[model samples]
Target: MSDAPEDLDAWVVTLADTLGLGADEHPIGLLLDLTRDAAHGVTRPAGPLTTYLVGLAVAQGMTVEDAAARTRATIAEWKTEPSEPA
Candidate 1:
């Protein structure tokens, strides 16, 4: 259940089509960047969770760019905390 396809691009296209969304319409680059940052700054699991929450925000009217910026900002700040950070 946790495995990734050898070809991520193909998998994205397949999933998007299955969900009736255009794969090209999504800001895949931005999302990937956010995922990478969250995984590194927070935790491995946070990467997908962060994207899932972002997806919710998008579904609820927030633009993907704004959501990503907000999440990235959170990751940056969270990494800079004086206390033990994730």
Candidate 2:
């Protein structure tokens, strides 16, 4: 996380480089867009978990773009139950 929230983009770049993910090659925008979709479609806490799963999908031979596309489709069809009786 950034010390100054305004520098989040810079922080992400630095963090990616430090982690050896390479800022130039990292799909930051795509991942962030998918995370945003998950957070809104499921719950705020679902964002990170969804992204983590996406990474796992990448490890299992799926391309990030394909995983993200599939995830977004699933999100579009998701029907979440309320936290409590409505």
For each candidate, give its TM-score against the true structure.
0.77, 0.70
Stretches off by above 4 angstroms in model 1 are 1-7, 82-86
How would you encode candidate 2's per-residue C-alpha lDDT over 1-86 as one tens digit per residue?
Answer: 45664486787788878888775666778988989999999889999999999999997999998999999888887745434434
The lDDT values for all models are: 0.84, 0.84
> Could you tell me which 10 consecutive residues in candidate 2 have the lowest summed lDDT?
77-86
Against the true structure, whose TM-score is highest? 1
Clashing pairs for predicted structure model 2, backbone only: none
Clashes of 2: 0
